[model samples]
Target: MLQMGIIGYGYWGPNLVRNFNVAAGSQVSMVCDMNKQSLSKAKKAYPQVRFTSDVNELINDPEVNAVAIATPVFTHHELAKKALLAGKSVFVEKPFTHTVEEAEELIELAEKKKLKIMVDHTFLYTGAVRKIKQLIDDNVLGSIYYFDSVRVNLGLFQHDVNVVWDLAPHDIAIMDYLINDKPQAVVATGSGHFDRGLEDIAYLTFYYPNNIIAHINVNWLSPVKVRTTLIGGQKKMLVWNDLEPDEIIKVYDKGVKVTTTEGKYNLLVNYRSGDMWAPRIQATEALRLIAEEFVHYVEEGGKVVNDGAAGLKVVKMLVASSKSLKNKGEMIYL
Candidate 1:
């Protein structure tokens, strides 16, 4: 059995603990947090699990076989490194680390120690995203032309990272997974409205091979929350509205075809619009799937979709976007 040790009991930490504790072949051995009040609250729900204020105590516990870090973005590298050095497999939250160098170091250390490193990119395990991946892989969407996403909400702002770093990682990871092509360059623009130096809103564009392009808009000052993505392809199009309770994915038979004429100036542009359909999505919680996968991979060797290398890929995009954002939308080549 894989004994799971979780650090942090705030916000996302509880979800992690709940999932890992119930996952097959794994159980919550301990939970560590600096806030004693948070620990007290968590302890009530998990009377069988141990709680600690000292993170080192949990890391050094011989009963713990794996560690999950749900702390702040800045603290990820240090905590994850310590966990890896302790000879335990590590599962960390998204935006893996503050920088690419830190992510690389952690990945290398995990590899050397022969430990698994899973990044908690929860969306990848969702039924909606899984269906989308199936469509793309089956060529149901044909050749993808462009990917555009918008994730906006009010409040829930962070002090450590800007809107791009905070929100863009989700869509970037999705786009990276769906689109097999690697990005060639990136450009970003954003501004800060409050006393905090972090940007409240940002726009990023990624140029990929074969004329494929991706754009993401992330904001923390929107009047209404929006979670939507549009993918245009040669044979069809898709719209994903995450807020919709019943139907999250809608695939449409729509596209534009160009016909060349005898003359250079003579050209015909045809638009095709057809039926739309929504595929059924499994209602299982994504975190539960993540927990199960982590335990399975740790006990039996196998490939992990959201491994440390995948997290590093997302971090590379974030770093490039940050550089472009700082340079006033200057394109940065990846």
Candidate 2:
């Protein structure tokens, strides 16, 4: 079994530990957290696993073959780099690194050391996203026209990053995975409510080459939580409601067609509307699949969908969006 060490026990850290502990071909051997209360809770729950306050101890342990980092965004590059250099595979939480440079450096280092790296983009492993990818790949949603997403919630405000950096990553990663098109430029507009200088509400728009466009709206000031995405295509349209208990994805056979006149002076338009269908999706836990995939990569040399390169793509968008936000939505080119 491949031994795993986890850093951080707050928020998302527990889920990582639980999944990795039972994931095939892997075991959680050590957990590190600076918070005493968090460490105490972990110790009580998992007495078999070792807990330490110092991160270096976990990284240097020979028993640990891989390290999973669930820490803050700022600490990801350093911790992951150290783990890779110390001959351990690395699994880091999403938004990968703070910038593209850090992601490129770590990717290069991991390649040189022949160590595997998987970024925790759990949504990519979800049944809803998987089904959506299948539909797009099967040509059901032919020639995607646009991608529109809205992810907003109240009060889990982050201190380090704005709402765009905090919530837009999920939809951005999903867009990157489903749509095989690269974004050429980004335009963002947002405002901060508090004196912390971090935006609580933001709107981002990405321009692609083939007349494809994507828009994302993220907010921390919304009274109600909303996680929804709409993908419009030439053949069909898709609506993904992440909060729905059942039928999270609904495919609508709807689109508008345009035809040129014989004289080329006038255009004819046609709108097609058909029945909507929701495909049955498997009820598998996404984190477990991610954990299993990580283990498979570490042990069997399998392919990882959410690798460093994928994470870097998402990061590139995030960085460009931030730059646009700073410039008051001046359209920063990627």
Candidate 3:
């Protein structure tokens, strides 16, 4: 069994710890948090697990074979590098690292050490997303047209990263995994309506190498939480809403039909609306599935759905988008 040390028990730490501790072929042996209350909560949750305030203690522990970093965005790179350099496999929360260069360096280090590096892009592990990928592969959606996603909620303000980095990674990662095409350029526009110098609202657009397109809207000032995505295609369309209780995902058999009328100057755009069906999703926790996949990667060193390389790709896209935003939404080529 692989022993894991979990760092940062704040927001996402408990989920990772719970998932790892119960995951097959893995156990969370140690947990670290600077907050005493949080540490107490961690200890209470997993009585068998050890607790520590110093991350180095967990990293230096010989019993731990892997370290899971669930800390702030800025701490992921250094902590992950230390874990890998110490000859331990590493699993980091989404976006992997802050920049593409950091991710690439970590990937290179993990390769040199022959250690597994997995990123926690949890949504891709969900049955809904997996089925979506399969449908795309089977051409059920036909030729891709556009991807539009809206992820917004009130509050949960992050101190380190802006709204785009905090919220858009999930959508970007999902888009990258679902589509086979690569993005050529990104145009982003954001404004800091809340805290000074921090973007509270942002919109990003991706121009794929193919003629496809993707647009993402993320904000922290929305009145209500909305996790919705629409993938449009020539054959059929898909709508994924995470807020739905039973039917979180619905496949809409709809598309825009264009036709030429008699003596018409332009083609008429007809709306084709058909049926909506929601396939049964495996009702499993995304974190648990991610933990299982990490163990699977540790045992079998082949391609994984969210490996270090895939995380790096998403980081590249994010960095490109951030650059575009910094340049007043100028088109930034990757």
Candidate 1 has its poorest 10 consecutive residues by lDDT at 257-266
Top model number, TM-score: 1
lDDT of candidate 3 at residue 201, scale 0 to 100: 93
Where model 2 places Cα greater than 4 Å from the true spot, the runs are 262-265
- After TM-score superposition, what is the CA distance of residue 16 in candidate 1 from its true location, in Å? 0.4
> lDDT (0-100) at residue 90 of candidate 2?
95
Worst lDDT run of 10 residues, candidate 2, spans: 296-305
Candidate 3 lDDT, 1-334, residue by residue in tens: 9999999899998888888989989988999999999999877778888999998999999999999999887888999999998999999998799988899999999999999999999999887888888889999999999999999999688888888889998999999998887889999999997557879899999998668999999999999999999998889898888888889888899988878877578679989888988888878888888898899889877889788999999899888988998899999998
Clashes of each: 0, 0, 0
- List residue ranges in candidate 3 displaced over 4 A: 259-270
Clashing pairs in 2: none
lDDT of 3: 0.90
Writing each residue's lDDT as its tens digit, candidate 2 over 20-88 gives 999888899999999999999999999999999999999999999999999989999999999999999
The estimated TM-scores of all candidates read 0.99, 0.98, 0.96
